[model samples]
Target: MVDFNVRLGLTPTDLELREIQTKRPAEFEALSADDSPELRLVEAQFAGKIVSSRLFRGEKTITVKKDKIVAIAKALRDDQETAYNYLSDLTCVDLLKVNKTEEEPRFEVIYNLYSLATFERLRLKAQVTEDDPTIDTVESVWPNANWNEREVFDMFGITFNNHSDLRRILMPDDWVGNPLRKDYPLGGEEVEFTYNVRGR
Candidate 1:
């Protein structure tokens, strides 16, 4: 057995420092709608189509929309005011609220938007159903969304409408169902381990 000192790479002094340090959520806030370039791009491109807009934690903001996500994205990337040239990362999360189906989907699709020039970040989100999870693809704005959308599609089963090519990126081409749905089961681990691991 490894000693406590050897088990953890951190020294006792390091642990003491960590224990004394008070941790708190980051105090990040986004710019106001009137002052934010992202909002201006939204007004210019989407006009009254935006459903609602709000700022959260002051670091990021969200603009809910009901139509033409692709078009709005294109304008944001091209416009000088909101030159969101970098698609930093794309991912999804499971709310696990069962109502997020045909009846209701407590599930939410969160989009993290960032700009290299402005050094600002925003979140664009849409609600979707589990039965027919569909959202517009941002691939037109960022070609990289081609694979990002596919990852969301493969794991969470959220369909991206108008995606140039929709296929599994991490899973096999003919994967049967979304693996990240929170119900796919942990059945494969033992089977995979027994098949591959040679007993000592």
Candidate 2:
């Protein structure tokens, strides 16, 4: 057993800190290495579908075409060698002002998958253009995607085709705009105070 003695504002000793830091790089290197079996499996399974792959800080992120997401997701979930059974999270990113140097798409729907048995994680991104911001639903592959997909749709206006019930999960059904988008209006509702109430 190990004792961390973790408490608010409590500083760890140099030896303890060094020990923790020393183990992180080795773990990261193991995951980020090109020889990982899971990585090879992913490459083999989705060869043509993969648009780009990147490794940053010991984490792998793979970008794929929006249309091929469902097939790729199904492979990741059902494959015994790469059983990414847990859908840890699903979200979208509005790349309106991001990576201006590259001609990347306007939006990207991201899926975080985890393997409870193997204790591994993978990140998959499917790019969606502003003109046609839609992707096939992964709800069939991972049922939890139902709510996560709805949240992404509500926040980024990205549609998930064949989703059981795609609707706004966080915002009102009549909300004017996707607040999370970079170009969303900054201010809208009027501030209310006791003085303002008296005037009204």
Candidate 3:
């Protein structure tokens, strides 16, 4: 078994430091929105659109209203200065039990983007409540989001509005529940061995 400390090429001291940092988020140095040029560009271009932004450990993440995802995505792709033309990955996170306090909008849809020419990366996020777990699709901005959005829908039940073909890409058409959900029951579905044997 690989040692946890060495697994990440980190020494024991480095692992301890990382653990401390993880536990103490307040100690994280908060950089102003203008500190990041990309963020500044976004703030200027899309005024009043950003909900929150973070620059931690050299990574940037911005949260925006769910309704404006498509517009902002298009801007990121088309904007000459912030040419984030590549959608690296699209996924969702269930924040049901992970949040310390009772945070609204139990799910967050994440979009990872990259600018090939500049080699700059950015992450965009939108929060949707469990009651209305849906967000605007970015398929118009990035055609590749078709399958990624479908997988998120299949695994988390977060619908992507205006998606051309938003169906289950991983699960069966008749699957009952979203398995990736935090509240989804463990090993709830019994294997239909009898049906398989009969068919055989």
lDDT of each: 0.68, 0.77, 0.81
Name the better of 2 and 3 by TM-score: 3
lDDT at position 8, candidate 3? 42
Q: Candidates' TM-scores?
A: 0.66, 0.75, 0.80
How far out, in Å, is residue 197 in model 1? 18
lDDT per residue as tens, model 2, 95-140: 7754454567899899988999788888889999998988999988
Model 2 lDDT on a 0 to 1 scale = 0.77
20-109, model 1: which lDDT tens digit per residue?
667675454544668777777787667776655666656555545535677777777888877878877677776673333354453456
Model 2 RMSD in angstroms: 11.2
Cα lDDT, model 3, residue 157: 96
Kindly report which residue pairs in candidate 1 clash with one another.
28-59, 29-58, 29-59, 30-58, 30-59, 99-104, 100-104, 100-105, 100-106, 101-104
How are the candidates ranked when ordered by lDDT, highest leading? 3, 2, 1
Off by over 4 Å in 3: 1-31, 196-200
**Any idea how many clashes model 3 has?**
0
Q: Candidate 3, TM-score vs. the true structure? A: 0.80
Tens digits of per-residue lDDT for model 3, 16-102: 454345553354444476566667766887888787787777878888878777888888888887899999999999987663456
CA error at residue 162 for candidate 1, angstroms: 2.7
